[model samples]
Target: MRLTLASYGLLTGIVLVVVVPFLVAVSYRAEQRQPDLSPERIIAASQGAFAPAIPPAEDLAVLELAAEQGIALAQNNLAVILLRTRDSRNHDRADRLLEAAAAQGLVQARYNIAYRIPYRFNTDPALVERQIDLLQRNVAADDIHSMALLAARLGFENRERFVEDRQAEQLALLQNAAATGDPDYLFLHGAELVDRVRNMPPSDHSPARLVVMELALEAFLASFEQGEPRAAQRISAMIAERNVGALTDRLAAMGLPTSDLEWLDMAGQAGLAYADCHYARKVLGDLWPDDLMTEPLYRISAGIVQDALTHPPERRQRALDLAEACATPPQIPEFRPRAFGHTALYLAKHRGGWPAIGDSRGQADVMLGVIAALGVFGPVDREKAAFHFDRAVRVHDYRGGVGFLDRLD
Candidate 1:
């Protein structure tokens, strides 16, 4: 009886040893959601909240395993990763994935043709021409955006043979885009008209010119009414550039309620004074080249651009003079130079801005402030410079130079 019990005990011990390990392995496998995600020779210390010191290999392995498991996002991510690798090894695969995403109408994929969507892509002459052809055929095709892009490309170009269609297309796209009230399109359309008028030929007095200008104004108004701050100032600029007939007279013809006559020259008052002959003439009329201007403001306050080489530079200067006339503020205070930039920063002086000034003098103050802010224009007068810089920074936010840092220094 004693011998039989001993034999049973030995058998039980063997079974326990084999079954324990098997049970532990099963439980471990069940607990794992993805992969073990471990690397050799890594130890953990204190970890931060929202941060984990997972091994790089472990993450890669888990993600790779997930992709193999047929996860959609993982698959998409893997496709992008392969494409971005920019290696001969994965380019074909990446291209296929990107195409697939594009086929799905993914917005990111739509933006992936090149890193940039505008001039960077359309600037290619062949590509733009092709897009124009496609748009001429259809705008709501699977690639309706082709028309949008083509119109956008030509807005600033103004090629002669295709002017009518391009303008029509541009108007359609801009109007459609405007319905959504997107500022970028408004700004782009405005900028394009400005460029076109700045380049139009003096002999090219087509009625289309006037229509395009009106379109630009109305477009700007739409955006302005939506609460863009610079709308009035930009319109004022357009007004000052016009030689359509006369400002007060033309606007008065409509018999609509309006602001003071003085405010008609708001852009000039805003300190965007000075003109090349072309723009100046349109803005200031006969006085565009210098003589002081009052009343009888140019009706079409937008400048029509002419060929730079066709018209002599002096003519351009004359035009600028007209525009400069628009800058005739009621009372512009002068300032001392050397008050800003290097002198102010390195010399440590408080030339102005010690106290706040109210609304009444704001216009003139701002005008002087503009002259001062654009310090590189004239002689260095510290006191005046400081006032200008201070005003520019405090009031208008010094937009002219803010972008300088982003430019190649």
Candidate 2:
């Protein structure tokens, strides 16, 4: 019981070291167990702080804490999670939370509210009007996505009410959105233009209408350049709609002469795969010179062809002769193999013979089968036709399936 002052101090120091560490560890564990509702923590968690590895439950705890304290971002995020849960009570709560966030002028929350109003909430006329008001506000704020969605909804879905009744306003909204050069908006604007062109009466087909259609095509090309995947399909459709004469006229209007291959070359260089195929076809038809021709030769041939059109019969033969002498065998165009293969199969089926250009073994066999079956290049030989058809079928040519079925019958 008789301890010296030095002994007492040593005992107290030892107790403090052990107790201090235990108390700190306990406090840290308690803090970790509870959700942190600090503004920084709420903002980070709202932005997916837990990320891919953590479960939703951990994220929900932190979000709930912040949302209960009226944090708009947290409210919006928690609303989204609740919406995904599919619980009826949570659905109502989520809608209320979204409305609360939107009332705070959160753009994303407004977008979500506008999107969900017609579908998730009952589509009352008042609610629809409210959603439209929010979308208009967002559009006025230069939110491009809202502009696109609103345009589609009003101009396409509720045309009679929102678009036809206010045509000029709707058009302005669509044009403004497209003017941003955003790929999605550009595609949508192009599509709307296509619809307008399609609906125009024959009597309405003036030069102005033609210019509008050309602008639509340019929009599609621009959208394709901006990485819109579906834009290529639209360009192909537009090309398919016009004949060579119409295309030539359009090119001439643009100050690009149709006598040369410049238009096709430009399109091909712009990543239009079908343009290369079309150019290859034109070369085979002698409508355009082969790519192997020297630039001077090409120009000379083009000039001769152009002159032949205006020349009298006596002079025309000489022009034709000069052009023919300048011509060379066509080379396979880059990016044309797949389209060429398909074209070869199409010619064999419809024209009764394959084009001498565009050679592929599978397509060649299909062509041979068709020729043999139809007596195109020789006497009909069903057995030989059947043999080629079988080979084509084995190679997964779906067209061969039709021939194989015919042979079996």
User: Among all windows of ten consecutive residues in candidate 1, which has the lowest summed lDDT?
Assistant: 339-348
lDDT of 2 by residue, 46-108 (tens): 544223232256667888877788888778776765655446998799789888888898776
C-alpha positional error of residue 265 in candidate 1 after TM-score superposition, expressed in Å: 10
Candidate 2 vs. true structure, TM-score: 0.52
RMSD, candidate 2, Å: 14.9
Local error of candidate 2 at residue 180 (angstroms) = 2.9
What TM-score fits each model? 0.38, 0.52
lDDT of 1 by residue, 1-409 (tens): 9999999998888879998889998998888753442321111110110122222554445545544554433333434444433376665754455445445544333333322223443366664454355444434443323334545556555342444665666766655655466554564566556657767997777888877776676666665556543444455556656465443354567562233222333323333242122243332222121211221212211212223234556754443344334323335544212111110011011111111222212223333332333332245344663454354456544322222212212
Q: Model 1: residues >4 Å from true position, as ranges?
A: 1-100, 114-150, 155-167, 190-212, 243-409
- Using TM-score as the measure, the top candidate is 2
Instruction: State each candidate's clash count.
Output: 41, 0
